[model samples]
Target chain A: MEVDRTDGRTPNQLRPLACSRRILHRAHGSASWSQGDTKVLVAVYGPKAGTKKNENPEKACIEVVWKPKTGQIGKPEREFEMILKRTLQSICVLTVNPNTTTSVIVQVVHDDGALLPCAINAACAALVDAGIPMKHLAVAIFCCLAESGYVILDPTKLEEQKMKAFVYLVFPNSILSVLPEVSSTMKGEPMEHGIITSVTHGAMSENDYFLCLERGRAASAKLSDFLRRSLQSKVPGDSSKAG
Target chain B: MLMEAKPSTSPATFVDKIVVPGDVVLDLSTFTNETIKLGGGLRQDRDAISVMKAGKLKFSKPNKYWVESSQRRYVPCMEETVLGIVVDCKADNFLVDIKGPAIAFLPVLAFEGGTRRNIPKFEVGALVYVRVVKANPGMNPELSCTDAYGKAGEFGLLKDGYMFETSTGLSRMLLSSPTCPLLEELGKQLSFEIAVGLNGRVWVNADSPSTVVVVSNAIMNSESLSGVQQKIMVEKLLQRIK
Candidate 1:
């Protein structure tokens, strides 16, 4: 059975995604990512001198500051910041810049739906723009589970309010490794199928949550391809005499 | 018998190609006898070498590989010449900001022919050309104003000039061999003294402040322009300056 979204999107169709890097001038790295009506602007600074107190000084630290479109930061914003920080920490090569603290400041331009996923995407792009060392790039996607047992890839604000549950899932980018026949799979699943972070809202059965994860993982591959293409297309000075 | 197994994937295929983090770039199983030096963005993961940043894979002959990318922030590396702004002057060292993760310490005695009695006085916020001596993790990098032989070889303070920041890639382009077209075109008409630091800082000086401004702006604008575009842009700027 096909699920019809309010925006006329099919169950598997995601909202259009747009990303631009190096958008902020003064920041070491910056990017703005938007999905449909939701947009997030991220500025990356530091690997600065030292980590914050309580943070282990032996390894690099990640600090995320979330600014909503309006109002002061509340419980939800704090949760978003924590989730974003941990998600970024996992993908980044923290040991490469030990004792340094990289700050990722996320400013919510708009939050129609899937706000956390958009912010995560923006932060990941900003980190890449800043040239921070990372083990891999991460792709975040939002999945909505309707009461009818159908899952939707990306939802709008109206759809989100009507959904029974929603989940934000982050996955490592599916890499096209140059190695000839080396398997990139773990057990029976591809490595990129492993979830880096998952945030759920409302109540859902274990089976429903796994369904959402499967749908979200499938959508993330497309997002990762777009990310890789955009990054490669705009390499600085590709045609210059620097080569 | 293992040496007879020729690897199908060669590192040469990815040279000058774009690679992102987690992309396996080199299969080390092929080169049993040869040793390869890995640079900034490439890391060894078991027998597979992978990239840790998004950039072009650059290979220099004999066996050196690295990832090159343009960015505002610089990760400090050893023996790199950089222009640093002194943030604070302590009794024995000066804290300098080289656009790196932390402030580097330029020892008071690291200068040429330096002695405890003749320590150079550098005011806070002074710009000096220095070389990174040590860049170990978990420690503030150390800087020296003198070269390896303890001589002040163009390593000192600038009397008067205009200093500007650029992407590290642009500064590298300015210092590339066969002098980039933009610099060549500017030099044909104008005379300017320029110092390029690997940490994305450039200093230019000319007889007139106007020339300094022109040279700096030209260099900054030429970062995204092609070689021919750079030549054309310089011509246009020189015309405007006149």
Candidate 2:
């Protein structure tokens, strides 16, 4: 087995995580989350009155503004914003804040391999901090298919560049442990884990994609555990109790 | 939907209930000649008064209804005093970013007893305490440095203070009647000068910078806390500082 992973971890291991909520005093809700060396700060504003231009009066609207680590916003940041907006819009209970706009401003402090997933996690944490109602919490993990067909979970930026294909997968908080038969949701049966959004950066076969999905979903339990513990700690007087 | 006659909502009951857009707040037909005025966060749709935003529904005495919420962006409203930072200085107006959607305009001659030769020169990035004079839709909000009697009235440049931004709700809480318990407690223990603007900007100054930091941190930590919680929190903070 070729041990090429930097920061010295197994293929499925995640980096050390530290996230703090309400870091920005001015924002309605804010959080700074870092996975390994990759860090992102997210500030959520609004749940206020009215939307920006092309206003939608029916359901709540979400706008994501992504600012890169350096340089002005360009096409890549715009694409990230679109992807994040869609993922957050799915999890957030929009009908709760109708005709209002909640803007999530994400500033990239550092970009390792899993930048998007970290941004999504930070945004979700910020939304929760803002007291926004969400159907379920979402967590993202980046999976890479190495040249040797080994799937690496939560790859760093350097690891991603060395990969054959990279897949970014997001999954809503779900019950762990789906049976092997149920794991392959070929019959449209409601599986324990549902993919909220999936984006592949390089070419990979359908089998490889599904393999990456399986590995990514299994590794998500650790991320979910981190989120639950962090959120519980933030809520005062609700000190970590059995859930 | 047919406009069936429904009982008007009690203003007292709706004072603090969170409301969403399109929620029919009051059925005007049942009011029966009793005049009621709608405030911000509400709009008239046909015979029913509906909410236009998501916030706690607020109602004042003598028939006034509005929604109250703490948001990052400040919607310009007439007569509200705000602290603004000058973004640019033009011949006629100074562009100020009051954390509003549109940049507010502070006219050069809007100061008290102003004349052509006496126009106050404010450098870019200067912080000024001003009142919203005009907030027409599709136009920039106009700001002034004078009160109703054309006096400066404690509205002017704030200097040598640590200015920090908070949510509009937190700032409102700091300025509420009877004073916020946190501010009251801080004032009792420490001698410091503080200014809270409706635009959510706060300036704190003291003989020592440490006091300013402690006061600002105490206030920021008290945003989601209750009155009693704020007092307890401030006590703990003060204890740590000592």
Candidate 3:
């Protein structure tokens, strides 16, 4: 049975978000991000000289630690940690801080929905505040497939529990100029081509996935705009320079 | 004890310009006959002086060059006075958080004319103004409350002020030149006591609590403002209080 979402936002609408950078006094880079009821604070440290023996010397290692608000980190939080690291790895220009570790600590303030996306957004802002070089900024969105095969973007945690499956799609802030909008299923749509990482939960058909990707890409422009504005305020003089 | 700097091959055009890592700031081939001193954020490679960090290239006349940027972590430098919080204490050293990569060790005996019988007590969380005595890589920084002649000289416990944090760049700006315009403008209207730490902590005290609040807010807001903008901001803040 299909039911209306409690918030009354359209299925394609994302929760409203607010972000602030450099919040922590001691951390090299920090940001507090909130989307609707879910809030996450991320602190990025290092590019300073510390690395373990097995790490590669030519590139910086990205470490993500997730802390729940009340209890020890359980398995779900651990999975989110790995997902965030992999997503961030694709965009961060790790070669700039060779032989060092950039640790990103994500603390969950509240979780109503789209926790991982909020965490990813916060981490990206914190990394920028820390001045880590990056190829592009990545934004994440959680979309769910209802029982009727209708897909919804930015579902709340409660909605997630009732949905059959969900997909986490991460899109880069800008599509590479190299891959303009050529019409091909495998490689073209600017939105589809710019995806850095995609994680699927439950069974999603190819059509459902593409539909979700379309919604996510459209939603991502808003997130990217918000991030760029906040970033401009933090580091004046250059808006295009991400390094 | 270094001598005067040698002439440059060709004048470097990077002063006050933002530079990124790997950007060459100077061509050693031009100034091969003269000695140039490279400071932090700059590395001397064969025939090239390159930036090691992203920041504005800051060149001090005659020969020193470094990069300046707003940073949260403090890399300890000798003789730089900073504000620190007491985190822990041992018989000989008190661990202080100077917002550095590691905790600094403030020797209990390094205070003004100190002896074992009269050890000053700094309970955990007490704030102190101290100078960096030693800052070697791979070693914990060392701090002292006394100057070269062993006098406190404004380096001691800071009390009864509202302590807030700003970027290290803003804190440095607050201590720079004839005076920061923001501070200058505020002084004309009200009286306040301020101790700025290079590590980004600022303690402000005034005759009334409202004055402290106004001054701190104005300073924080002035971080990204120009001198003229800062003056306007201070005026607006002062007007609100009036």
Candidate 4:
């Protein structure tokens, strides 16, 4: 299943992205995000103490609710929730908001495919909007190998069907922080290894696995840049020091 | 010591010296000198003395000057009538975005006096007439839809309507318009109070029965005025009715 990714973009190229904070008036923090045609609105509430007895008391509990258009909770929504919860928990400094729950609610008003990764990005933006303390912002990128052996980055719905496997690239801050520091000082060191998190190959060959990992790393790096820029504009001031 | 009397050219100068405790005198001889020498004070240049007068001059207390600018006051404040939306409702209050400088809190207790189904009766996106019971800086604005008139009485209440975005200054103009005859013709004019929050939230509500109609008409006709200008006109109009 060969897929011709739009714009002749390589498997490492990310889609155009836009993010806005305080998109809604009621929520503590709200953000609207769009990656290609996948648009999602995420609202973050709390750091307010949770009511349920099982709610965590030592660290902030993250609950993600994904709503798709015209249906109840489905498999795709659940999968995105799990992935987003895991990815976000790793980056967020939950201890800062102890005994409270930070809920990330993502409403997929429009789905043009590739919803999970979009939801993850939207949730990250919402968390930032809510002013949550995080060690680093988490960014997710999707990659897949086409039937023709070409890997695609940020696959659309139509392209997803033609792919054998999809990988979600999760990049932490070390990769970005190291790139600028190393490029200026070292002569031979590779500028790419800083990608701390990459989930690839639910099913794929060893060769394809490595290829997907490389693609994931490259794509995640690009998304990290995009997320930084997006968060910068919404926060009204330099948020780099937030970490 | 007697000082030369100065002619009043600028109102500010006359008022400024009036506040000082002294008998201000004017001398014609100082006019030719381009400078005046005072008995108990330093010699002042010609520009400092506006004019010269003769004889013993009597000084009086300076009148307080009230500087009025074109700016309208419409930010949301406590106990002021306001128009807002139910962006979100909590157990005790609703978050309202007033068209002024900040968000104001309208507690459920503020509405307790009015006839409404119950607390938290409003839903998201519902527009209602509310009063600003409290406002905190950099905090979520709370609003109360229930007032003496009840849940935005038929004419006074606005559930679904077009929200015209304009500056707080302009909204004041529309509300303060003195020349607007519609208010007087309607009779029993509405009493309204406005609070312009520092966060750019504007809250307006009318206490009189005719307030809704008059406000709507004034706002509708205010399309020609810009935001700040409209507020001025409205403020003037509202003042005349009161």
Candidate closest to the true structure, highest TM-score: 1
Worst window of 10 by summed lDDT in candidate 1 chain B: B1-10
Instruction: Estimate, for each residue in A3-63, the C-alpha lDDT of model 3 and write its tens digit.
Output: 4788887788778777887777678888888888889999999756656677776677888
The DockQ values of the predictions, listed in order, are: 0.73, 0.04, 0.06, 0.02
Of 3 and 4, the candidate ranking higher by TM-score: 3
Cα lDDT tens digits for candidate 2, A1-243? 556676779888888887887778668788888888889999998765567788676677898899999999998788889999999988776664566778899999999878999999899878866656565678899899998888888888888888988988998764221123343243674432688999897789999999998988887877877775676452322323222
Please, what are the lDDT tens digits per residue for candidate 4 over residues B43-116?
A: 12222321111011123343222211111123344555566666767666666655433445566556544434
User: Which stretch of 10 consecutive residues in model 3 chain B shows the poorest summed lDDT?
Assistant: B1-10
Chain B TM-score (model 4 vs. true structure): 0.43
Q: Which residue runs of candidate 1 sit more than 4 Å off their true CA positions?
A: A235-243, B1-8
Higher-scoring candidate on lDDT, 2 or 4: 2
**Candidate 2 displacement at residue B134 in angstroms:** 0.7
Candidate 2's displacement at residue A214, Å, is: 31
Instruction: Arrange candidates, best DockQ first.
Output: 1, 3, 2, 4
lDDT values for all models: 0.88, 0.78, 0.78, 0.54
Indicate whether candidate 3 or candidate 4 has the larger lDDT. Answer: 3
lDDT of 4 by residue, A20-139 (tens): 766675675677777777788988875554424775666677888787777788786687788787887776766544555677888997887567777777777677555555655566
TM-score for each candidate, following the candidate numbering:
0.95, 0.57, 0.61, 0.48
Task: Write one digit per residue (lDDT tens) for candidate 1, span A1-243.
Answer: 977777888898888888888878899998888888898999999878888999989899999999888989999999999999999999998898899999999999998998999999889988988999999999999998888888998788988888888889999998757666545567768778989998888899999998888788888889988888767865432211100
Q: Positional deviation of B164 in candidate 1, in angstroms?
A: 0.9
Instruction: Estimate the overall C-alpha local distance difference test score of candidate 2.
Output: 0.78
Residue pairs with backbone overlap in model 3: B9-B30, B9-B31
Candidate with top DockQ is: 1
